[model samples]
Target chain A: MEESSLLPPVVLVHRPPALDFIDEHLSRHSFTALYTHTSLEDSLQDFLSSHAASVRAVVSLGRLPIPAEFISNLPSLEIVVCASVGFDHVDLDECRRRGVVITNAGDAYGEDVADLAVGLLISVIRRIAAVDRYVRSGQWTRLWDYPLGFKLNRKKVGIVGLGSIGSLVAKRLEPFGCIISYNSRNPKPDVPYAYYSNILSLAADNDFLILCCSLTDETHHIVNREVMETLGKNGVIINIGRGGLIDEKEMVKCLVNGVIWGVGLDVFENEPEVPEELFGLENVVLSPHAAGMTAESLNNISEVAIANLKAFFADQPLMFTVQLD
Target chain B: MEESSLLPPVVLVHRPPALDFIDEHLSRHSFTALYTHTSLEDSLQDFLSSHAASVRAVVSLGRLPIPAEFISNLPSLEIVVCASVGFDHVDLDECRRRGVVITNAGDAYGEDVADLAVGLLISVIRRIAAVDRYVRSGQWTRLWDYPLGFKLNRKKVGIVGLGSIGSLVAKRLEPFGCIISYNSRNPKPDVPYAYYSNILSLAADNDFLILCCSLTDETHHIVNREVMETLGKNGVIINIGRGGLIDEKEMVKCLVNGVIWGVGLDVFENEPEVPEELFGLENVVLSPHAAGMTAESLNNISEVAIANLKAFFADQPLMFTVQLD
Candidate 1:
């Protein structure tokens, strides 16, 4: 405790077990890592007030919003190092005003997240989850007429964001002979896939729409009912991005009314609590916000987050910096 | 009925609703397609006896065994046009002895079958089916720690065969960062994947094994108890080939005993009847034998099988000829 108190540039943490370093890595650099809520520990305000201006860095380990009220407590905070790819939870406006630099787990979990996205799409379209249940229930013995699934070969897939995750999915699906097209914030040069300025045109021409865009105010509910209607009865929607990217209520109605064929969701608008109506549908595949929770990716995230902190304390260039609003 | 009887060189079929033409193709070709068993079906011997020496071909529509006795009954049969890829059900020795030609549905369903193989592997490793059931059963509402899945990044995958379907699978998994190696009857010089002359070494090194070889006498039960043991508790097996290629009884035992991690099976030693023990396992994903049964592939099979039959009648080189034992 005496040695840790002498360490420079104290770093505030949300908690441990959610995220942590290897101990030796932090000790070698000599930085004080203070965790906030460690099993009946002090409230965030009390801890922040006690430490005050000494806490120049905050290591965010969870997906809860860091609003103005919370940031106001840590007046001397200079940097926020996030342990996730999506940072929609963080208040960008407040961070920008305070001149707080931000860094995220960039391209570290990209490969693993992309793997789950393709896996989810294949699961929904192939009816793997539904058919597995059928076989487990001894229905295979009684039934010879199992429903056939649509082939991935030559099917058109529309990508919402052609960033790291979307590009990886495109690279993977190309070998299966699927035609790739996308709609993005702006058309990317040097990408051979067709690009549409409008999302509706992208939906009308493709059999599958995969949402991989970052969630922002301008991008909220980007895939609403009208876009889904154009994708039609044979279309499928797979969401690996934030749930707010889609109009979940209308999407549920589309699934129920057969306006769209099926869906595979990993995130929800209100999560740990899914829409109760989606529970019984055979055409849907649901996962509880676990697309990026693989053990390997978690380790990579810890390493990346630690590296950014080390860089910031030494007054060096960051590994990655989020674009402030 | 009178006009149909006047057509030449009768072709015997197992039954209707199996495989057929869309009226115009057969009408243009001017051939008699006789379906032996309809609602009131005749015995195989009785029907063959009635057709006598005029039955010039047999269009195999199902996976039912074509024993030596059945081939002897159709003495005038010049060719057997099968509508499926795997000819394990056909009596290849009997066909060879009787001087009958055999043509299978070659490479037509390769893309679709390959698609399912990748799907099943992802579904098993990611626990897509198990978690899907949990989500549907209202378990997500409780404070439950959902299990995390392994990532596909930089994992080694061993392929059992490096043929059409196997090659396609390797191609698909490459962008996922999975290293591909293989076991085949002989090493293919042109293939880029590392060659394993023996399967034991392949199993030892890889985290996942994908079985995609054809079933034959020399290859039966290639993945036996010893191979499964070497694959170890963390290894996953994905079988898109014939069921007999694996000893199902031993596999069930290995799964029960935790010798291997998980299995994704589409084919079985006994069709329409899976082992009852697998019904309770959460780590397994079972699909009915619908890997190559996509609507698009079915159309391709019908066209190719019909073409082979037409080529046999016209004394032209066959589209494909199975190498008889």
Candidate 2:
């Protein structure tokens, strides 16, 4: 007890300058920052080499990558607590190789992401945003002729990767009379919805495709030109999943040529740099990669991350630990 | 049978030039327009006097009022077929006094209006429309600081008038983890949600108030300043019902002063002329009275109106007949 009181465990926080959400809540821990400002390149190696042995756990914030090279420097690192739902930014293989455990934000963000997915779908189908512009600009008064939007009821909705977020989306959409289906690696026994082993069949049968899968080598660019072609002219695509899951160039072209009906994108292949072509088109609704972000959800995420870190320091079981295999 | 075949019942269509949806489908029966090219003033009295005896049914299109004066002119008018869900535009007392049966669009618009109500709720809470604007205006790259929106999960949702549209709204919100309650003239026996006898009590208890009631004498200005005050600063109001359902002036003040959280208005007291003050606010999402204007719903509305007219002519039971009692 005397030794423990004298020396508290160290936690290394690696985050972008804008994401200092954990600083206030992490007061109990003996913490060190690897990068305080924008440029992590100048002091990253120096900080890692000096504080390598003392750091017991690293808190990765936002989507900043924690690659193999970064993991190799932290020899005493016992766990990586990611403050996000998607841990694709973290090197799972490296962490597993070093016998390091990883815990993600888990269901902390499931409802929020699912909420955004549903919002985007309805917005695109109903032309909520487009008509908003019309009303705001006083075009409604002048023209009195606004184009009619499509209905969401009984439309075939295909969810890609029915994980925690995707499942929540399906449940929320059920009462709207949407015929829900999915494309996943394997079908679960419990769910009532039809499952396709591949993306093409799912796209071909559905009126709308909602992407909720994680980004990985096998899953990256899963929604390409062919998958969209099969989805056809009347189909709509909604991506609340990672940007890498879709081929952005092909999507833009398809939208331009009317190969697909429309899309609602919260994530883009190159974020904060959306294709300029989308700006002129009324069919596409673009968001600034804000799915999984809300005041309550952010608070929940910080609490989960802090709790996981606290649990690790106390030698207790971690929450939402990732299966490395 | 020979007389019926020789001279079909004449139906009077009193509608604006733009609302000629029934023209193509009404060829089966003899239909005459009161006004063809936007000059109803020129021919209304002449048309009414000339065809009063022959006109068996009046197909009231859009919200053009069928007042007591107009009802008095049509001496032989047996029924008023409203091609809209709401029949407040038709004088109920006069219709009842004259033994004129009234039929409305009924459940044709139930799903679409409910969909828009939910869409507006999510859009207002999540800032979906605002964020889309931010992304479109190239502000996302410059600021990197979009304001956080509130979560919808577990929110206390109070629905006004738990009828067809309100019931569907409540049903759709259930799976999103929203706690549902409602304000109605009487408690609905079949619904599982909690009931509030008045708007004030409902507003006081809930985080979100969705107005789905008809605009009648009892419901006009239902959401006044006092109601908004009771709803508090964190509360949101979504009105897909009608502009008259709320006191628009007070609502504008509440939004401007932050007396309430935000609003999503598809209807205004004077539509096509939304309050200029609401234009600059980020919290309010304005829609152009288009909640029931989806293409599918429009088609459904037309079909239902036509079917009801056919049934009335055939002396079969009418569909969606409004109870005069």
- DockQ per candidate, 2 decimals: 0.51, 0.55
Q: What is the DockQ of candidate 2?
A: 0.55
After best superposition, candidate 1 residue B296: deviation in angstroms?
Answer: 0.4
- Per-residue lDDT of candidate 1, residues A177-274 (tens digit): 99999999899999999999989999999999999988889789999999999999999999998899999999999999999999999888887778
Candidate 2: where is the Cα deviation over 4 Å? A1-12, A28-35, A38-57, A67-79, A91-101, A142-144, A323-325, B1-5, B8-12, B16-20, B27-35, B38-56, B68-78, B91-101, B323-325
lDDT for position A68 in model 1? 79
Candidate 1 residue A185 Cα shift, in angstroms, is 2.9
Q: State every prediction's TM-score relative to the real structure.
A: 0.87, 0.89
> Which model scores highest in TM-score?
2
* Chain A (alone) TM-scores for all candidate structures: 0.88, 0.89
* Model 1 chain A weakest 10-residue run by lDDT: A15-24
lDDT for A272 in candidate 1 is 72
